[model samples]
Target: MPFAQIYMIEGRTEEQKRAVIEKVTAALVEAVGAPKETVRVWIQDVPNTNWGIAGVTAKDLGR
Candidate 1:
């Protein structure tokens, strides 16, 4: 089995997240020869307030 964990700031639409999962699964299947059904992808969305960029929070940085 191949597993991928992705972290990004919150606010992506459902469609965008879906695409990420699908594309990531395909990449893993092609790169590691994992079966499509055995590929696992997890997306962790961090709130802007909780995510930091340089010395500022993502929210403050307008991310």
Candidate 2:
């Protein structure tokens, strides 16, 4: 089995997230020869306030 974990700010629509998962799974299947059914993609969304970059939070940076 192949597993992928992606972290990003919480703002994308459901369709976009689904597309990401599908694309990531396909990539893993092609690159690592993992079975399509055994590929797992997990997306973890964090609030802007909880994500920081440089000296400020993502919300403060207008992300």
Candidate 3:
């Protein structure tokens, strides 16, 4: 089974989230030869305060 967990800030349209899952599953199916049923992806949404970059929070980075 090719399983993946992706973490990102919450705020994407359902379409965008679906696209991510589809692309990841497709790659796993093609490159790793995993079956469509065996390929899985889980997206974990975190708050902006919990995500940071350059020692700054995502909210701060946006400022």
Q: Would you list the C-alpha lDDT of every candidate in the order shown? A: 0.95, 0.96, 0.90
Candidate 2, which segments miss by more than 4 Å at Cα? none
Off by over 4 Å in 1: none
Relative to the unseen true structure, what is the C-alpha lDDT of residue 48 in candidate 1, on a scale of 0 to 100? 99
lDDT of 2 by residue, 1-63 (tens): 998999999999999999999999999999999989999999999999999999899999999
In angstroms, the error of model 3 at 46 is: 1.0
RMSD of 1: 0.6
TM-score for candidate 1:
0.95
TM-score result, candidate 3: 0.93
Check candidate 2 and list the clashing pairs.
none
Ranking by TM-score: 2, 1, 3
Better of 1 and 2 by lDDT: 2
Alpha-carbon TM-score of each model against the true structure: 0.95, 0.96, 0.93
Collision pairs in model 3: none
**CA error at residue 31 for candidate 2, angstroms:** 0.6
N/CA/C clash count, model 2: 0
